[model samples]
Target: MNKPEDAPRAFQQAWNGHDMQALGDLFHADATFVNRFGRQVRGVSAIIEMHAPIHSTIYSDSTLENELISVTPIGDDAAVLHSWSRLACGPAHPAGPHVIDTLFQAVLTRRDGAWKIIALANVTLADPRTGRAMLRV
Candidate 1:
């Protein structure tokens, strides 16, 4: 990726396309990830393993859209990026078709002139008034 924030958009596209190979290419070999469900995983292959099944099941007809919120550079090679994502799940989802808003924070580093995610955390956005997970239209 040309910039640190580019990772989110790449992720959105890869997920929307249901391309696991493309998704795996965006992370470092020893990368870490925490999903919105609070499941934590490490390593690129592990991340792919955890995500692959979902794409064919609950997320088979899902689409993801991400908007970069901020990019904070820690150095010439390291940066932190925050993005908001809207995940529209398909009817295959256990809860049925729905739209959810999520927040993702990623720590990326430039390696070999390409930016890759080293760590990422994802959370479901909550409704402040209800203190519950928010579902959007």
Candidate 2:
């Protein structure tokens, strides 16, 4: 049993490692995820399904560098996390090789003595050159 502050750090480690199973396990059964692309995926199972292919194909060799901005506890069972991450897509990516940074916010809940992500939302930081969104999540 880790402290509440470790939850987001653990998630970032799992994500950077491209461990889908571990990542999925960090979400509550009824968790929901939203991306900057306006896509919403609900439930832990659905979240797993949504990320399976992504983990296998696109992010097979990707690396994520995260900077946790804040973690605010909302009662004893829940917390909100604000973060920024730099994503470096590997050669396996279909969109070609590139690196981008994105800002994200997530709501996490402690259920059954474990910290799980309940809701997540993200948006790209924007590109300075073209003034366009760089990352989708």
Candidate 3:
């Protein structure tokens, strides 16, 4: 499989499964993650911690759908990628099972023959009605 596409697909699977450990495993030890909330988490351990609460609460039943926009190879070992995505949130969300459009980006590097995400960022699209980010600030 193509590593560039495979990596994020695995991430999406882990997220849909609510498996924080597997999600954290996809990131490098010193990886950085920025969420739609604008908070940043550094390091895999911290990243896991950052996701635990969300996975057990608001985003508990969320699933991801991402379409790869581009994958730019930086060398045999690294690449940057972007995707158009949506988070389908279930009953736990106030709106209930609505999908939120998002833009995703990541930088991945090969370590020990496996691609690991070094940086990840998710941006929420603006609400068509209000012209402001769909996510609460």
Which candidate has the top score in TM-score?
Answer: 1
Top of the candidates by lDDT: 1
- State how far residue 102 of model 3 sits from its true place (Å): 0.8
Q: Candidate 3, clashing residue pairs? A: none
- Alpha-carbon runs more than 4 Å astray in model 2: 127-131, 134-137
Task: Give the alpha carbon lDDT tens digit for every residue of 20-110 in model 1.
Answer: 9899999999999999999999999999999999999999999999999999999999999999999998899999988899999999999
> In candidate 3, residue 75 scores what lDDT?
96
Candidate 2: RMSD to truth: 3.1
Model 3 off-target regions past 4 Å? 127-130, 133-137
Write candidate 3's Cα lDDT for 5-84 as tens digits.
Answer: 77768878889999999999989999999998789989999999999888999899889977788999999999999987
Residue 104 lDDT, candidate 3, scale 0-100: 85
For candidate 2, the clash count comes to: 0
How should the candidates be ordered by lDDT, best one leading? 1, 3, 2
**Residue 57 CA displacement from its true place in model 2, Å:** 1.5
Clashes of each: 0, 0, 0
Q: Rate the local accuracy (lDDT) of all candidates.
A: 0.93, 0.79, 0.87
